[model samples]
Target: MNGCRAKGSWVADEKDTVHYSGAAGGWGSVRGMTEVLARERPTPAALDTLRRQNKPGGFMCVSCAWGKPKHPHPFEFCENGAKATLWEMTSRRCTPEFFAQHTVTELRDWKDYDLEHQGRLTHPMRYDRATDKYVPCAWDEAFAAIGTELKRLDPKSTVFYASGRASLETSYLYALFARMYGHNNLPDSSNMCHETTSVALKKAIGSPVGTCVLEDLEKCDAIFFFGHNTGSNAPRLLHPLQEAVKRGVQIVTFNPIRETGLERFKNPQSPVEMLTGKETEISSLYLQVKAGGDIAAIMGMIKHVLSTEERRWREDKRHVLDVDFLAQHTTGFETVKAHAEQLSWEEIERESGLARADLEKAADVYIAAERTIFMYGMGLTQHVHGSDNLTTLVDLALLKGSIGREGAGISPIRGHSNVQGQRTVGISEKPELVPLDRMAEQFAFDPPRDTGLNTVDACEKIISGEVKAFIGLGGNFVRAIPEQVKMEQAWQSMRLTVQIATKLNRSHLINGEVAYLLPCLGRSERDMQVTGAQAVTMEDSLSCIHGSQGNGHPASDHLKSEVAIVCGMAKATLPPNPKARWDDWTADYGLIRDLIEESYPEMFADFNARVFTPGGFYKGNAARERIWKTESGKAEFTVPTSLSALGLGDKEGRWRLMTLRSNDQFNTTIYGYSDRLRGIEGTRDIVLMHPDDIAAAGLAEGQVVSLASDADDGEHRQVDGLTVTPYLLPRGCIGAYYPETNPLVPLWYHDEASKTPASKGVPVRIVT
Candidate 1:
């Protein structure tokens, strides 16, 4: 491996000390950078004006959606959020002339960072094949062209795609437009991640979202964190963990490797800690479970808890099981107990890479806690049997009667701010019959009852030529999906590809037969609706709905709101109707709210009046109160029969591979090349491997290896030149960043229940 030298710094070799000349001078460098940024370009002072109570406006954070605000603070933005905000607020633009200077083919070769670092899009563009460049197009002309194209294809053949970054109103409008146009083909970013949580939660507890809120974190006596890296993925969460530690809360973490955030954290906010260079202890007990062994670990914990409770009940009159809650609010306990009893400690230890004593200790902590919260991330849901893993967690929560409580429940940390909102507004390609029927009646159009493709299915459809056009409502669609080569090819094969974005990305470079990049305003930019500057709503992980008003100037004067773009496309595609007036909604976002109010009256009641309040209302879930919506009106326990049943790592000697993003990144965007907390720098080629595994493979540290997956279908998938680094990870487990390793994941491989790609648990073998 070669190290690049910084400007004015001599290259160090052998024993010479390595230093970052660019990062030296600490706070002075940061202060100087801020000055440089300000001097480079003038920006709106409105952005500096903080919201009342010093909290960010409820618009979902453009970076990552980890949790919501319970208390206001002067500093709420995380590191990644700061990067996202700074990137959005940059005084740079990519005008039509910039596109005119470069062809799509030429732009395709540019790095992901260079493509987006060019800054925001300044105008709507349409590809001109004759000129081999994209030229500016009037909003009306673009809308009209989209309408003409919509009329040419069958509604089922056209897909309306959405990203998690979209606002609640925008997502609602996108879904309404699709239903009104007679198709339910809504493939979204959720399908690429966390779809398993939705599926498992709905089946086990009769709800799709997490039951715990941010406030609940403070109230919990203990928290069990699974398969998530708080340091990199959810940095803002570090404060809460720090606070919890200060309050004597016990945290038990389960992941393949010990994450820095979960080990020790220095709260930058604390003057004493900052001055003394002291760190807050995070995890009381850290268990390094093997990748794809989350279910086994969870099952082991439950098994221990049950046996201990039984033994105590026999000796003393103490019972760990909430018998009353179980008898009233749940069923199938007998079956669950029978299956759990059959799981031997040996098998559990072998599968989970955790000892019986470790699991017992964790269970003891859970049993002692009056209130506990179980939180997990993609690590628990990126396996072929991810839904089962989720079910197991739900079963544990139910066993302890954690739901409907103030301090305890199951919480799955969502990635995007509005991802939950998108799902709430019906972005799923597979809509329930009730929503479909309600939408059909409300829109005065018969929506197709047949199920539609998810992200994986959508890609397969495009590749097979079954899908014709693709319309994205705010995301890098090509980068988010699995199998990069196939995704790019499928995108190119589309008849028309429309991208509604605030900036340029690799997705825009992969053009269709007719491509259009429609510039849209960002969450931090002012959006002028017919009702004047308006606010958009976003639902946090805890189901608290909040409103956000952009304080910054629009990226471009020509950029439109996502709702406006959807209305424009709908007007062009659908027949003119009195009740479902797409043009009227486009004129003002308030009218869209009015329609939502009329449609989902139960949830969107007083949509206009309630949004003006300081903190938005909460969308109540009956399941959160232990009122199950299942067929039996109770939570159900599902028993996973065999490892093969999950269809992950079924092949011999095949280990499950999970792809994750570094702390410096959000989704497909790579702001920097280093993951500071992980001790990785300069490059993204390093893979996390167990020391024992490296020795077993006869590979020395830093050895380059090719990770490959055998395709039962006779095609080979491989990711080469991965620099292996021995870390404190569970044996038989490995970790690498995504998109770069996405090609190794087959489109056909996915969770059966949720249809989400198994990006977290791909089965592969290592070669040197």
Candidate 2:
């Protein structure tokens, strides 16, 4: 914490101030985007890239998984999208010469921001143990070395990790190559983020992906925002929400802290709004629930609805519930009704930190709206009972029959651009979730049927020396995961690590004994194959599959496409198989698309032709069609017995810590030091606490403090040197930016079902 400026260290800045009262988007957003463009990519070419983003035949935005409109505006990109583009298309390069100047040990002390700020990686490099640096290496040589190491170790001992940045074509090849190598150890960013959504939704509604399309939001009478901050995560979505508010749609928000984006937003894309300073107020009702209290809060809403329906039924036999939809399309209504009736108001109030009257008000809105969309983010999913929290949300939706139709369905707001697509194309660890038989028939090889490890499991195995090899598609793997201290050290002990990325990150610096750093084309860069320029497809959160063709110049001549990199690794590792046409597939992406159609005929039929269709085509969800694919063949109501949102009970002097992203950042990638929406600038190492909590702890504004986890686990986890800033939130709930505060969350403290790290509800105490 002292010497190294890595994850744990924090720097105090006099310029940092808290004045958190402003609309999310407007001139401020324009200014932020302009600043990034000026610093990173201030050129006509960069502006052109922005114009084409999210447009037909243009590159997809590498930001969030929000879908594009049928007829998109000329400038569909948002501030976050602009930052992601410049971050990828930066002129700065991390060459072998630069790597030679700095040793791994020395580079470890540098901050995560500094490491990535070095810019796009320029060439293939291999770790040199003798020199303690990364030396230039040929792509062929690096792949051969990785293949030889893979041949030496068991396939189960290796982990094939993918970030959500990879396109559908690249992800398919990556998944194919791993199964050919004899294992399904395919762990990706989803395991850390939305695995709870996948697990819960699949059981409750029969499909993992969200049922609603972009148009559904427009058609909805009410939009419920549960633990989701749309501004920082998906800025372009603000335009839609702004329009919804104008249309008189009831926007109900339930979160521990008041996110400005959820409260009000001025459409940055709208010139009149920006010029006239007309901000559209969002969220007709804002309920600030305690951290990890989403389950209790949602259940409270259910309780109110159930009580009202019962009273109305007794009065005149009038039904508040959708009796027909419940009887025909779903089952287990009695279980949900009984569970709600059993819950006490005192217990719900204590757990949720919400009054009964407010819950009733929210329920009334839900009851009045003909169509409502239930949307949630990591806040509800990253808990001990994360799956239960989601299922409980599903129960509420089912109570009012707010699903299986247009404008009414569950939406899990995913982070990365193609995160949902990766899982759809079989980048999953679960053997049952993937089509092993079809894959075996297509490849003419026996596929591995054993369940693979997830992010948490993979890290534990890496620490225990069970996993020897690590292959990342595109992400800061070591830096993004929890238990930073242990995982970073354990990552170095692997036999071989191959990172296929667009830029330099802390993960590349924390090299394995025999590590190969292979630079690949970013989403904004041209990915030319043997068949001219290639167009890849990505599935957004709405399950729309669209074509994305990069139009910019490559960062370096040595850079290859992610598809090519995966094919190269496959050729180098797998034994000669007549059925596997890696070279042909790499040459013509249409062949890959054809094979994808052959593998998943139901979803990817006519993939090559339909992908080129304007605005892409929907991958059709069964749940959306009211066709349940679950074991029961019907939507099931799951009753979560536990009232504790996070199993961690209330402890004296301990605060429920929820990690979040700043307006300037997305996931683990830090764009700049300014969080303009929050009125903070210069640093991300500050902690957000309620004014009452700050005074109760005897802490003054800007006072430096440390946070230690209150887990019963043997390890003492803490983050030091955090500046205290007073923000309006629930009294016992505090907030800090993630990856910086990841150390406080233990790897084992995750959702019981999904194994997703409980990042939103780590019980910690502030220590001076």
Candidate that scores best on lDDT: 2
Cα RMSD for predicted model 2: 3.7
For every candidate structure, what is the RMSD over all alpha carbons to the true structure, in angstroms? 4.1, 3.7
Question: Candidate 2: misplaced stretches above 4 Å?
Answer: 1-17, 42-44
Report the C-alpha lDDT of model 1 over 1-768, residue by residue, as the tens digit. 343222334334211222222221123223432543453242553246223311545444676776556565566665556566666767888898899899888888887777887888999999987877889999999999988888898888888899888988889888888877878889888888898988989988888888887778879999999989887677778888788989999999998766767877776556676667577778999998877777788888889889988999999989898888888888888888888899898888877878989988988899899899999988888777888888888878888798878889999988887888888877877767237667667777777777877887788888889888889888888877777786786677788889999889988888888888999988877788776887787777777777777777887889898878888888888887777777667666777777777767887888887764444577788887788888777988777754222355546566667787865578888776655555556777767776677788787777788888754656577888888875556677678888778888888888888878888877778877
| Residue range 1-768, candidate 2, lDDT tens digits | 221112212224212225455688888888888888777753345778888999887878999999988799879888899999888888888888899899988998888778888888999998899989899999889889888999999999999999998999999999999999989899999999999999989999999988899999889999999988888898888888988988999999998877879988988777898889889899999999988888888999999888888899999998888989999989888988888888999999988999989999999999888899998899889999999999999999988788888889999999999999999998999989888898898889999999998999999999999999999999998888989999888888999998988777788888788999999988888778887988899999999998998888998899988988999899999999999898998888899899889889999888988885666799899999999998899999999868776968887887899998988888888888887776677888888888777888898887889999888777988899898987777888898988899988898999999999999999898999
Give the runs in model 1 whose Cα sits over 4 Å from its true position: 1-60, 643-646, 650-653
lDDT of 2: 0.87
TM-score of 2: 0.97
Residue 459 miss distance in model 2 (angstroms): 0.9
Count clashing residue pairs per candidate.
Answer: 1, 0
TM-score (C-alpha, index-matched) for candidate 1:
0.93
Give all candidates' CA lDDT scores: 0.77, 0.87
Q: What is the TM-score of each candidate against the true structure?
A: 0.93, 0.97
Instruction: Estimate candidate 1's alpha-carbon lDDT, on a 0 to 1 scale.
Output: 0.77
